[model samples]
Target chain A: MSVYPISSPPSPQAVMDTSFWSLCCYCGLEPYLWKVWARPIWVPTVVKNQIFYHAGDYPDQQAFQQAEHEGLLAIRDPQIRITQFRSGEREVLSLAQEVSATALIDDFSAHRYAGTILGLDTVGVLEFLVSLLEAEIITLAQAESAYHQLVQLRATNQGWLKWAYNQIKQRGGNP
Target chain B: MATHPQLPLTPEEVAELHRLIAWTGLEEPEALHKLVEAGLAALRLEAALHLYATAPLSTGEIAEQTGIPRGQLIRTIQERRVAPYEDPTIDQPALYRDLDERLKRRVARWKGQA
Candidate 1:
């Protein structure tokens, strides 16, 4: 296990919300998303507290811990404290701003903050799956299956699901 | 240093996103973008409060409707003191009807704002 360098030159990073990470695991997209993330996936301290420490015995906890331990996931503390949102979401939004990175937020409310207030590019979990599909990293069936799995977990909304399905079909993928 | 590729959303995806945005009853793109800026917890608490005061639904039912977890709903109910169990003497049907009217007015105002 290695530590990700905090002082490394700014790279294309994605500050993830705890829910997004958990949803990825629930949708069985962990391995593919991990491979696709080539760069460091920043995980704010508050998110670690919420997803790993507080969410007791979740199946994804071990994998997330391992990813962090292996330097694939970088655990960071936001220098600027944001009091407007909940801890994990606040830290994620703050870190995304601090690094000028894309906010990988799955929660609707949190995504709004990133998109409207912070004026940052926001990507949802479904969008990530779509990206993977577009990059040929995953098949359309895999993306659709992941969407269904996420639906079962109640981690996604109907509107986004339909949008993703339509997007997949338009991209010449069989959704 | 590694760079991440952008998520490949086609023109059709963007159109679909706009359609979904309109479904939220907001015509302006900016207004739709502003929809969920308020925290989910706050929205849930507001919804919970409305349901607690008006609806004959249980805490579990409220949680289901609001997408809040049952455990969190129980804790919120206890902390907020807004459950039926806390005050069993209210006229449920009358309260429901009253709140229904109030909520309609609020929604109309929100739509106007949008």
Candidate 2:
């Protein structure tokens, strides 16, 4: 718990969805994200519910609990029309769209919706990991470990993810 | 420098075997044995990847379906590099770079650092 940031970045505040939070926490990057992103990432209140109730990642739950007094995970409702997506995804897109901030999402459908439908800047957990590496927030070994855990957590067969992993492995964690 | 074990066969079965041998003009069964072995390996590889690609099953589940051991399946996957994550977004690193300026603005902020 006594992790010191290798460096800091101006991480433009982004609206986060539940899966993104859960995945980051699941892969041991939650506190690092909290320490590195500088700006408090926004999340809908329902996203809070999703994290506390639905998320199976204990680290994510614990991270949220520890972050309570820090005000890094800002909770707000993006009051909007509901869609076929879950409240968390809908609200993240809504909030990001309303404020024109990037949406931090990892679910494939929600990720696509953020970029293609909402026309907002979107970043997935992988890109965020790369950003952390580029900013010197985490070392390459940490990135490699985090990514391997992420790939296992996702349990996906998508090849591009492998390609991206290879790309990151090929590059140094330099900004 | 090889040995041939005698196969238990009835006269009719032997006749049928000879007929097939004559039909194919084959002297030994080594080729058929190897072909079947190679086919099974191909089937297993295909089944494993197909099971992985079609569902979100863990490597254990895929191994269960394909009858491959979990560790073996993982070793094979790592060696071959299959079933990557589903998104193609990482192809564009420039898009991710645009936001770096915003994130790189401040120095390390976590407390209790050396």
Candidate 3:
């Protein structure tokens, strides 16, 4: 594919990439996401086709179907095709640019590019959980439970996640 | 004429170089330069992989430190088993802060909408 410039500073629309969406499903945060945010979340069409359709092992397909039925989740095609990173990530960035969206990312490499290279605003799983805690929407215990599940799923025992866990505890006013 | 850089070749290497010169018509300097370039490229790739797997260099840092282009570097990491390492000095703290700010904005926006 011919290389084209794909640059979009995140502005308004909210789109989640495959990895972030998968993380939500695996971490049992799908219901919380749709419940807390009063907006439609989009996934790139490629992600819907590639991962979601074939995600037979995911436990929350029915919930996803319900969200789609309620118009809380949807799929979209990237009008601009940016040839960088993996194809799915390229699509996510492109779709984010196409809609001026805040791109949600979980893959570390793609997350790096999305911030430093693409300059798109992004949200990680830890941030989302922390946001829920800060909003008084979910208790600190719920956030900790979700974080534990995330650690088990990704095997990513990173210090930064612990940092985020501390941020959640500190912000939630728990000693 | 400019004197080309030289490598002290053994007797067997000289004979092999003569055979290669006869077949490929590449002078000794050009052949050695090309081989050295290939070796350096391989060395860079190995070092990049090692730094990636062990240290906490960001993808941008890896590309900047090594001379690999971003697209090619992304493809190489994608094809390999390299895991992502967050730079504690530069990216990790910044990443945590960025998350905090962005999600705060999101939460505030949600509140306004509510």
DockQ of all predictions against the true structure, Cα-based: 0.02, 0.06, 0.08
Q: What digit string (tens of lDDT, one per residue) describes model 3 on residues A1-175?
A: 2111112222256777655665676666766665444356787766665444443544445556666777767877777787775455777778877777777766566666777787887666666777777777678777777887766543232644766677766766442
lDDT of 3 by residue, B4-92 (tens): 34656566556544544443355657656654667435545555555566565444356556654433444355446345565445556
Every candidate's lDDT = 0.59, 0.58, 0.60
Best candidate according to DockQ = 3
State the displacement of the C-alpha of residue B28, model 3, in Å, after optimal TM-score superposition.
33
Which residue pairs collide, candidate 3?
none
For candidate 2, what is the TM-score?
0.56
- Model 1 chain A worst lDDT window (10 residues): A1-10
Worst 10 residues of 2 chain A by lDDT: A155-164
List, residue by residue over A1-175, the lDDT tens digit for candidate 2: 4342424544456788766776677677776665544456787886777566533546667777666546676887775644635456667788887777778776555665566677777767776776667656678888888888767654333442544475575675321
lDDT of residue B42 for candidate 3: 53
For residue B1, give model 2's deviation from the true position in Å: 64
DockQ category of candidate 2:
incorrect
